[model samples]
Target: MLTRKQMELLDFIRTRMGTDGVPPSFDEMKDALDLKSKSGIHRLITALEERGFIRRLAHRARAIEIVKLPEAMESGGFRPRLVAEAAPPPPPPRGALAIEPVHALELPVMGRIAAGVPIEAIAHVSHHVAVPGSMLSGKGQHYALEVKGDSMIEAGINDGDIVVIREQTTAENGDIVVALVEDSEATLKRFRRKGNMIALEAANPAYETRLLPDHAVKVQGRLVGLIRTY
Candidate 1:
């Protein structure tokens, strides 16, 4: 059995980790739990750890792993459920009206991009999205991808959000870029080069950073804009 506060903490951790690929920071937990200080958050974490609910990852700041779920919560339907029924997407405008002149550039809608784990890139044009030309500031052809996971949620890129990417083969440090690994898999993460290794880092605490040989990772594009539908 878990105390109400403990249950709340556990649920928060689970939801955050599930959606962000990392555990919530102490400040985030404090704010969410309405605690006065980090000490109170520490106490709650310690209690949960002592009961085998979560484990802290050594050498990683703000890192935590859910070891097990509370039996009662799982079996008693205590977890919150997501609403699956979304309103149908508004139909795309067919023709321009003289009253409301819209100037936009249509970009290919790439299949999908894994925001969590690296997945094979589905290289097919599904459709096209009309975006304001002002939003495409970078050079090279721009494409849009449907983000499929929450690994980049902490960076404000949520699952199902369409990200406009500027196609490029190079990126600066700390740029959130689409990276292809071994020519077979792709993921969206912050790009960094340390000595000879390339690291693709997630903004969330739940996912570990991926490191590879410098020649193994290819930069697909840099994220330049985003469009969230509802």
Candidate 2:
């Protein structure tokens, strides 16, 4: 929930950064709202920042990135909580059932692995895959993959597990990422790219990491949610 002024600030930050990729300074913010002093704006900004909405540099210019656009405000953001107000339940599985955005698409478990062997062949799909998707924001196609190795054990992904992969191109630092190596193959690892060097790092110390020239790496999608059951 956001106060009226906070919502305005949210809009201000998002409109500036989402369109321009740069944030505004305090003075700029003050001018945008036509306030007499920066204190009023500063107080609201501090509150929004504390609530996990924005990030600000301690002592730098242009230090605000719009994390979430203020879609809901105190005045009009109150959504009715009636049983009848709920959205219709998702459709049944397969064949034109109503599906949420980015759902777990069933895929095959393929084959087993031996060290120094090719990634594996989907000789027969031992099982199906289920990838999750967001109904509100991620209203797109979805798919899943099976984990083959323990390279990401530190990241809590283990061998012989179903790894949900939403197809995308851009991701942030520390996102458990799926990537393509040299256009020849694909692998799962934590991805971090800056400038020319690319590092496909493993979370477990037992596995050797792969370092690639920036041109050789292609980022696929970021990890946002997961599902596991015993």
Candidate 3:
């Protein structure tokens, strides 16, 4: 028998693929189960794959295929545990402004970006978040990254916040940007040009500034906004 968590994950994958014709991403699975880490989602997925409940296609992103679903879900009796165990949200009062349906723009949430030490960039799109077009500013393509450190806490960007970034190769001074250093590592910092050097400045005093020649730094994107899940 599948554990409750495994059952929950399997149900989610089936439901999502049935709706969207694509398997949900790791981050989506994590959010669906109220999981604290993607590692937990990975473990659960591996268990399902091992049990013949799902198949992961090789050389693909979000390429999971559901082979079997729990009887509970198949019978239409399985409400997601995260939803079933939680209290229902109160209904909006009558005559409250009707919510207008707005189209959402889905952006890839790439792997985590460091706010301190630069980390090797992961090119795969792990998950995505849908934000209304109004939430974004420019016409440039955008992507999202999860902040992993408190190096920018002084600037109100905290660990665990998902930052929406506008793709660009150049940034103005004082703009918070995702910078690719030496074409290998990526970091989130304030962009600065001082004399002949390009500086990636941390918002918090605890971290020292990194200075390199202008050619060594590539501006990946500028901060657009952020999504923080409660």
Candidate 4:
């Protein structure tokens, strides 16, 4: 039998994966369960894994596979989604030099970025995701963020899409960027400047453009490329 916290965590993970095609980050789980620290989450995950409830992928950040559901969840007709394992490539021809695959690099997924209302600034690395090197722009450093809202839908950015960001402290007008608001909250929006004011514009008509003092906005990074999983 699973503990109450364990069941809650499992249900949360399954629900997030079903919605976003990715599991929630440790911080998110911590917040959802109202736990004081991530250590509690770690222990609960270990317990679930020991019970054959989930599998954590080695060397992958935040990668988890749901192995089975409890009887209660099963009666609800929940179907676990299985991630197919990639088969090993055939051995190179005898005497042929083996070449490593190119153009793919592992980038840290910092955390979720809000595309609608601004959320707390994400400063820690949650996990790493493999991104095509070509997706990176002329960058000093690059990172990935899971988008969390639909305000940028008109720009072709959707909730659950992974956005590749080139770290920078500046942006041109109309460029979509990760904007840190008041040094506390972060959002994904188009950047616009007028006089000494900065405008964070949302693509969707439902969201009004937020105009703030230039000093209140900081450009964390600019959007480079996006990846979406069906």
Candidate 5:
């Protein structure tokens, strides 16, 4: 059985998609449900997904597919629609070589990592997300992290964006990386070496760069690519 908020969110999505041919944005959902923050909407969406009423598409902005509806909604003529499908690519010119289709691989979305303040260390996979194979960096293991704050926005990373990271222990100055701090929290920031200390720099000026002893910071992975859903 769905919670009252979950049912309301599901119905809102259904109504918006029926009229707009696409699901509403997170902001829209938040407003419709009178939620205090987008996090509430995220939780409601996840509940619906786990209950088999919806599915979130990977690598697409605001791509949600309604899989099933409650009996009341069904009686009202709601139809399931796959909203993430992209139109076919254009054919190559006669003299040019044909491009191969892009292949997708599923990678574990370990959990949300902070782009502002450091969050609890992510220890286990929360879910899987399909990523384009081309997005994977050279040969090493890669994983995805859902960004949870706006401190990296100036670097093109934003809250709610899923970042694809290549597993690595070392990074050059200015490289965005997931840094485990003091072994208890993890944050996404640019890595810098300053004398014997390591600087975790945020791209947004609103946040000050955090400098800690080199031994206190552990480089978990270097960011290679990013995915965002509108």
Candidate 6:
């Protein structure tokens, strides 16, 4: 098991590596963690290595490698990565995959769903995103949704933007959530609750705020990012 410090360090490494395509150096980790000295960061890495949580190049300068998870686990669970190439290849890439290799996460354009006034456009799935699998809650098992309307224009969400939505059914107040409203419509808006009233506030004033009883609105997912393609 990883200790708190080791786990935190591990998280930093994984996040940076997965997203930035590089592992953080000892100095970067030191500064990120606010350690008084670079040695402080090294001490933590040493501890992690001792715990079988990470590995490093033998006498290789600047080589701090962590043990990556199995391919099955990498695609199935949440495994933070600080370095992008620390592990082996995942299953062969699917030919139809649209994302580039350097991006952190690439989501398939499923189809478009309504965001504002619900249109009937084939919703020509706008584009894909480069995000980490760990960024989403359910890993590769997670699917993508095409945004349909402009109800969330105020939130910077526009028509045809492929939103990275985490699959979830519950969210905290003030979270930009993808809600299945009345079980018939899915909306992307700010979650607000006041006793019995639940309001989905559209960031853009062009669309009116949606309000309903708590029972009438259900959380679907949280907005993670927007994918815009040329």
Candidate 6: global Cα-lDDT?
0.63
lDDT (Cα, tens digit) per residue for candidate 6, span 40-156: 787788877876767888877667676853232234323323334445546666785554445365554435657775333221223344566555665422335667777777667
> What TM-score against the true fold does each predicted structure earn?
0.56, 0.45, 0.58, 0.58, 0.58, 0.47
Residue clash pairs of candidate 5: 61-229, 61-230, 62-230
Better of 1 and 3 by lDDT: 1
Error of 4 at 102 (Å): 3.1
Model 4, which residues run further than 4 Å from truth? Answer: 1-100
lDDT of 2 by residue, 136-182 (tens): 12633233456677777788887766665554665676677666555
Tens digit of lDDT per residue, candidate 5, span 94-115? 9999877666777767678999
Query: After superposing candidate 5, which stretches have Cα over 4 Å from the reference?
Result: 1-99
- For 156-184, candidate 4 gives per-residue lDDT tens digits of 99999999888777899999999988766
Worst 10 residues of 4 by lDDT: 76-85
Measured by TM-score, how close is model 5 to the native structure? 0.58
Judged by whole-model lDDT over C-alpha atoms, candidate 1 comes out at 0.80
Q: Pick the candidate with the highest lDDT.
A: 4
Question: In candidate 2, which residue ranges exceed 4 Å CA deviation?
Answer: 1-127, 131-139
Q: Give the Cα error of residue 159 in candidate 4, in Å.
A: 0.6
The better-scoring model by lDDT among 4 and 5 is: 4
Of the pair 2 and 4, which is ahead by lDDT? 4
Ranking by TM-score: 3, 5, 4, 1, 6, 2
Scored by Cα lDDT, where does model 2 land? 0.58
lDDT scores of the candidates, listed in order = 0.80, 0.58, 0.80, 0.84, 0.83, 0.63
